[model samples]
Target: LKYIYLNAGKINYVSNLFFFQKDILLILKKYLEKQDTYKCFEILKTFEKKLDIAFEKEFKNIIYIYLVITFERIEKGYVILKKNNSEFLKNTLYYKVIQKDIFKNNGVYMYEALHLSEYFLSGYNSENFYEDRFLIDSFICKLLSVLKDIKIRNLINNREFLEEVIEYLRAAIYRVKNNFILNSEIKLDEIENKIFIEILQYKIKMNTYLNEPLRDEEFMMISRIIYKHLIKQKKEKIKLKEVIQIIQKNSKNCYSDLIAKELLELYPNLIENDIDFKKQLGLLDIVTEKNIKFTRCVDIKELIDLSFNDLYDNSFIEVEFTESIHKMLEDKKYDYLDSENMIIFYGKELKYKKELGVSIFFNESVMKIDNKKIKYLILLSNVDEYNYLGVSRDLQKIIESVKFKELEKLNSEKDVMRKFEEVIQGGESGF
Candidate 1:
């Protein structure tokens, strides 16, 4: 029978530690052909929500595997055998709700249904998971609120760590509710702040989940997370203050410039305090202001008349971007350009790296390249190897924008720069 054959394949599949053997893979592929993946995902998402638990982030493949196996078995009339005398639990609200809501139409029998429901609740009910989630959320909220009360609001602004703490509490709550005590080498006394411990203990006692206090291991882990987070916050503040002082001084030294650049990247919101400093930080962005140029050039002949030296820091020469030249540049085989008499390159060809600076030739009149007329040429050369990639990506986006084309017709540098800023601000693309 097909059911027996599939069961034998499944046994092999499980024996291989869930790695799909060729036969099982074939069966899964056949099963998935008639199944909607999205539907399976929806059921999986529903199950997670009902249980108030998440699978691992990359759980889709595993979910689909299990779903395929389970459904295929059911399709072949291989429902789980109902266990005798478990009818009392089958009548509970948790079991009833899950059965009705999740598996009512499915032919998953009593044994399977009971096991599925029990996987989430253990001996408890659905209400327990709901209450546990609420209690955990309230605990985190109150702890954060206490920080606010003590005027330590700045540390609370570390949203990344705050989210980590929230997720940690969620896991801790699950463990505590299930009476799964985590065994850890961490000691509660290791935390230096007695006041912090007392505050945490008070918060824990006040907002206990499921009539159980968090185990010593869980308590110490949570305390360590908070303590480390606070220490990191203090260090960051000191670093920021030092960097700001170095930048605020009337010095244009390399050391100060480097620190300013790093600080700007780490705390971009600091730009709100100083507009001029923000403009200086603009170089940190892929599109540097000094590199953009608006010019009038109708043909290749007109290129000679343009002041290439004033436009870019690197020397410029016009050369055809031949297949060999492009290949040589891509392979980083720079020996071909070793001759002093080698021709210089223009803006659009700068990624080939004959030069090192930014140049945007926003030509008012169309220029001919390989006998094809072009509106603009973007030349992005950078000492940083990865910088060209970023600049090219931004340039490609600008070229794709209809607004950028309109700016080209106007031939206004201001409008082009404003459009760049708009893109940087993550405004609507249509604007």
Candidate 2:
């Protein structure tokens, strides 16, 4: 009975609460009195009767700690409340809307109003129709979710995005750092600065307030998102010579490791000679060396030969990632994936890296499938836009089938081999 109401979006059940449509408040109040707080959500399902103005006022009492649980659950499109325009997703009846912590009850109302506006304002933000008018809508109820998202939220309010994104990030890094705040005495100030520097370098937001910290859980979420996305679109057309030139010249204007990793994910062949990457984090100091042109730095013959192997071993396919998607990838949710236009791929590399051209994106926001598991990417034109959605079942298969890998696995005793070379050269191995 409750399930039918959630699917019936056109009926304004909450609005009709004034007419005694259903005793939603009675049910919620009983749950609250019992202190079985979790049931607050369960009570919200009673919109089975019809919506009334009182229902919105009643449900807005929900709180925040449940975001971790609720955000993931909403992807199933719950038999839930009418949480309109919440990018945070699966709006809690009591969930409050705070922009840097302010009580804004009407934002949800405004968000719905905006959807109505979009009907006349085509190509602005998409909308759904209700009766004779276009209705603005999102199921998530957090202001930050609706206003700050890269896809649907207003660009003017990106601060909200940064705040939310950083919060998620801070939580993750904080967990990694053990709950110490940024700049606290217990943590490394250098790493904090690195985080700040990267955010600033990427122009994530003007040097406003520090972005919200990502929790370990959220960081884990983003990391998974990045990994899956990179797997689907791993194509790097930038010539080896050009990459080598950037590193050799010691140019400061080089792509970040995020770009490098994504490109490498596409052109798994580049790993043949990218020892600097193996040795350095993000290839920070390695991609830059004075007097080295990418073309002139090393012999491409070895790298090229590796790429032709039917079995790719040199690339990071087997490579472990201590690297993060926090700096490299974006969060993609079910709403983004539900749109059928997104494309998916399994056996190919991205045509281009982050700088542009034939890029791949993962629908990193993981959701349950038949009480099982899946890692998927939604291949599309712009990694950020809603242009397409296609599923890629196995990115490694694409890499393997494309004949992308070239480097053989390094012998753990490769250093021993180097020592042998040193002995042959009349040098000491210090043995």
Candidate 3:
């Protein structure tokens, strides 16, 4: 099959010959004078320069048509809504084009221009297409792991069918990114294999950067593809409810492990020097297994200063190490403080070096951050940066627990660690 780039000349040749008029363009120009139509032309020029391909007049005209249509629709309170695009592309050319100063200066029509640019660039950007294969490979590996049924297992053996699915997904992701509606005649109820549909949805959500739910039409299209090549190993019909219940029960148990494993797999280099990762799983004994110090401090800075010595004593971090941690705390102090006047400083940036340590600083007197009183400063060295979600989940339980009150009565370091562990473990803190 040939990859042909169609333009308006080929699409509207007959209509153009019959009803072409330049006076219509004059009237339309006045109507769209305030629309910033020049922004579309500028974006197209940059796209052409970047791709090193000259666009014919016909393609440019089609893009102009798209721009006009977008404005007319938006006037009627219509806007395109779809899932986010691939992070790689979004960070690269797509970001550069849209973030231009000219585009941002009252260039409302650039929205449609951006979508039209992506439609062509996604196909023409060879570098992105090459890099996207790694993402696709990772996705397929996850897909195979999720679709464990024996009948579905055989589906991967068909190379043709597999390639078709891959192409379908790539196109679907681009369409969703460009806010192009996926129109399908098929309905979700017609799909017989509901379990497979759920598995497909789970895989897409896990693998891609899509933050929104897929439209039913999109799922219907995907189901049609899978049903086309699906082969049954057994004639016996199984109850859908029973199968779904079983899957859900097992999935809940392994969900966290799956997420952690995927994170480790995706970023092995970041975890290479991570001492905490080398330890046994669930060994985030932040209170009992690390340095604990008690001192009278009136403010967050003093508390931070006291913790630096413990940071060195416990993990042997240098001055720069403390500075980095200090900077992170200073930057994120507002966000880190919980309702219980607690701060958990754990971030992904610290995972790069061997500076892995946990320290707890208990203030004898009250400390203040942003005029709010702070009592306990739990300094967690970064294990996994993304583990903030787990920490947030556990922080709520810890803050509301009665066992946390025992920390105020502790005197010695040993007692502090013991009581702190009791308070933390009692709340079942994930960190």
Candidate 4:
């Protein structure tokens, strides 16, 4: 019987012992195969008045078809039963209607009716089965608990977001169980910014109740949800003139003036304060050497440690770059010019870090001049708009000026250190 049931879709075969029961069995089979669960519910309701032991031919046949399919699916490992309890089917409107109007609250008969409806209305797929409701509910509870800890529960307080999250998680569990692939349209890193990734890490830490790590697609989807609900709408509006003035004071060059002109020409909305300047700064700060600051000499490791400690104190999160100057030069992974001795990277300092809408830059240098190794670090803060203002070009010009004039004076490492100290002290004679 099981073999015949499993092969029903393939061979167009029916059991001879059930020949007289063909019509109802074929109707139930058609409904199950096509996943027309509502039709199955209608048919199940028609049999509510019949006793289980003395069911009418139509009711008996539908029950037989359902039993065979359920047993076959179980044998084939298509159904997984969790040991948790759930009252979703019993509490549903359909179940209530059947109990009140048809079963008349007869405990014995109501149980049978519910059993039949659970299989039929849920489409007989393990993914849609009532028992899995416990798992989904548990997952949602865990998710809510984690969100509450992060003070982000208010963002998802509406029904639409809740339903969407539940649907996404349910689909994720189904895909995981079936070994299916779920692709994300956006790259994980592109949408998963530092704060978003932090939230996800917290989620992962809190999701210990789950049996497995979540799929990357699930993480990406959840990140997108957080981004849409929280980050996108909560962007800080900063003063453009204040930021430009800071850049001018820090650099002490026409570099800020050049950037101001370019900004006015390129992004007039900034002057009018009509847009989120922080977002604009993020885009503008892509230049290689923007927000330049020269610092007194220190050992390489000490410099990195000091920079890391200072930034950490100031609400800056460090995103470690894989390719250091030594690694890059040793592996020849990237083309480096002979004169290109320094590397720098920067990112926005999130509100979670310190003052909201600020940016931080880290510059690391390793210089080898005349058998002496010179190491130093420069820290730039709140100047992400420098790149758009031609700071990198201005920096190169300054480097050229220093090389042409001060290189001859710097015969030893101590001379280089003295010159850098002079620059830090606002002396007239340093780059």
Candidate 5:
């Protein structure tokens, strides 16, 4: 067995003729076992560098597996290398890369490896692969947690696809756990949040009934309206039934590609394009068919702010904290009006019974004021930093307080938060 020793700068030296010879590998391992701990790593680096130099030119046949362990040095960027020279290689690739695409100086790892990650995720910035097992495990722990989001989970819709993705992630995780004995000090809060969000999305996709019966005219109006809305928002690939539900509020929007594609998979038919239908209408003048004027805005800010006008009516939803409810608020426009003493509670409150409450605002802030000094607990809008503190008695009193010059001059959002703290601090209710 010819063992290959990982030499210094061998990666730079070897061009394109590198091959993994198990016999050579066995010899190198024997040599490393005889050397000191410090010298063991030197042996590995020498082999890696040598292989890099050899695989730069001509077609090369080498080892089938290049396992890497990334740790502290490169933010845990690890990689696994495999040969791709035939039909089997094409099928194995996460991403396809034709030969003509590799004309640059940083040929193999830089361009080729990155493209390959589209199907397989070994690590980020995988240039820092080394023999350090400990470092690899630590980073892999964080990565697996982060990548557990809906985007990753949704990548595999069915059982087969799910199995494939799990297989890749599992291999990476297993390699780190077994090879690199790194510390697992990742944030639990983040991991839980991501998992919850992923699950919620999965549930939504797996279950929801999205529409109702409507006249052909109403259906056409809905289709046009949905097209206009999605176009205005510049959103694409949205479910047709979801768009339809916006027009039919009573219907549930849970249609799936497997169950039904709705408008996306339907025959084309326009209401106005049919001439025979128009002739059947005897009382055409009495039938009102007014086209509603639609407004289109390209500015995201304007579009978001367009949704902010609902905070004055005291119409808000109560959110409980259990079952990862916080994730349900994503991609929504709601004002959370939190006062020091509001009756609503959201997250920590739901679990283990804490004071973390969530008052989703659809209208005016809801808080009952008595003697509490609004301290610091307040609502935050992801859209912007605007927060509405529950008024002493509603917007009317708030307006009056400002008019009477009783309320001190302050930033609106700041004033709201402060007042919210005061109300929560006090033990009062109602306007």
Candidate 6:
């Protein structure tokens, strides 16, 4: 004999399962209303098995919060449809099925709900390719811990830097894991470079998530960010006179006045000529020109290409060429009249039996001459004191002045020679 629910008491017993589910939902709703996020998470955990298959164990909390917040928004009639027209999300049958079945609230749009579901599924299933909030947050916590231990935490904007770093790390980690190549144009200063290496080394040692050594470009990107932060901190602290002094001391032959002038042009309020530096020693460490000639009148490519042998071979004053310059010419590193435009050597050269110092600068670029693209190499040679830093600084200034039209106009070998002589004579007058 079968027992039938013929009375109200029987109906209560038969519907006990529905009431239990309803009780759980009521508890979840109360947690949400109270804004007790942790309790809401605990309640979600209890009904984890009933959630969509796309919500993985690791991302269950995140998906649950997303769903609860989205449901709350729907109830408030404030559904926001983010613009994501990803073909992959649109083409997936799982996305379509979920859109049709789970997110059937009257207020939520079909595609918008599908997009959120697809995002959760992609993040969960493609763990190797993408990083979710949990992974990123955990990585950030560990990173901050290491930074704190290193004692350089105060040097950066902790919150801002970490947020940016987390995003970069997420992308970087995925690329590194998959052995992908990334290209970057960023370069770091010496101090920042050292810091980058130290930070990367520490991260590699401490973080198990980063399983392999990062590419140079990846390191460059990180270093660039750190360098920018360092620069921002140092900008106000760096005095113009101090920077000039640093350059003067390092360059050895550069005049402080010239350094001051160049620096003022680059940064107007950094230095004044009459300022006294009796007590303070500058802390900026930078690379500066020490043993080169600077000139503006002559093209570098034209100067290198000039047949030194043809011009000076018959002259009364014989020029003794150094073996280093000879090797450089043979290697075709410098721009020559009949050779490819290449720059291999640039520095002070010993000329005239090593008695007078000659500074040579060779830098190459492509330019349009008569509407045709031509490889232009610039050469600046000056006779100065051996390893004179002033010569290089002067040459750099001159090169900076050379315009495409000016370079294109002087095509004759005689004109090039005259321009070279003019630059050398002009540079020597200042010294």
Q: Rate residue 361 of model 3 by lDDT.
A: 71
* TM-score, predicted candidate 5 vs. hidden true structure: 0.16
Which candidate leads the pack in lDDT? Answer: 3
At residue 300, candidate 3 shows an lDDT of 75
**What's the CA error at residue 82 for candidate 3, in Å?**
9.8
Worst 10 residues of 5 by lDDT: 280-289
Q: Per-candidate TM vs. native?
A: 0.29, 0.18, 0.39, 0.26, 0.16, 0.27
lDDT digits (tens) for residues 294-370 of candidate 1: 77766543442343443333443333433333443333323111111111222223333454454555666665443
lDDT of 6 by residue, 1-431 (tens): 01112121111112333333567655655665555345435433433334533333435545556666765666678866654544646566555545655554533576665657555554544433321222333344445455555566653333335546766866776666545456435667787777677777666643543335556677668767765654554454447666766777788578676556555555543343334532211101111122222223244334443423322333411354434345444433332221232232232243433222232333234533323343443332323222222333333324434533354456544454455445545632322
167-225 per-residue lDDT for model 2 (tens digits): 34433333333333333323324433443333333232221112233333332344333
User: Candidate 6 at 151: error in angstroms?
Assistant: 20
Candidate 3 colliding pairs: none
lDDT of 5 by residue, 348-404 (tens): 112222321122222232222233222122121211001111221233232223331
Residue-pair clashes per candidate = 1, 67, 0, 2, 58, 14
Better of 1 and 3 by lDDT: 3
Those runs of model 1 whose alpha carbons end farther than 4 Å from true positions after fitting are 1-128, 148-152, 188-196, 208-212, 236-431
Between the candidate structures 1 and 3, which one is better when assessed by TM-score?
Answer: 3
Error of 1 at 257 (Å): 23
Q: Which sequence of candidate numbers ranks them by lDDT, best first? A: 3, 1, 6, 4, 5, 2
* Candidate 4, 1-431: lDDT as tens digits: 32123221232336543343577667656655655334334444454434221223333345556755554554566643331112655664556655665457866455544655544343323322222333344456456556666667554343335556766776666556545465436565564564356666666653553445577567667767765656533555455677687776787554655566556555543353332333212212322222222334445444444554554454544333212323322332221122334323222222223321212122234554334344423333323222221222223333433641343244454454444334333422111
Residue 147 shift from truth in candidate 4, angstroms: 2.3
Candidate 3, residues 192-279: lDDT per residue as tens digits?
4574466655755444523334455665576666666563322334433343345567885544434444444444333221112322
The local distance difference test score of model 4 is 0.43
Instruction: Give the whole-model CA lDDT for all candidates, comma-separated.
Output: 0.48, 0.27, 0.51, 0.43, 0.28, 0.44
Query: How many clashes does the backbone of model 5 have?
Result: 58
Candidate number with the higher lDDT (1 or 4): 1
Model 5: lDDT equals 0.28
Candidate 3 steric clashes: 0
Angstrom error of the Cα, residue 240, model 4: value is 35
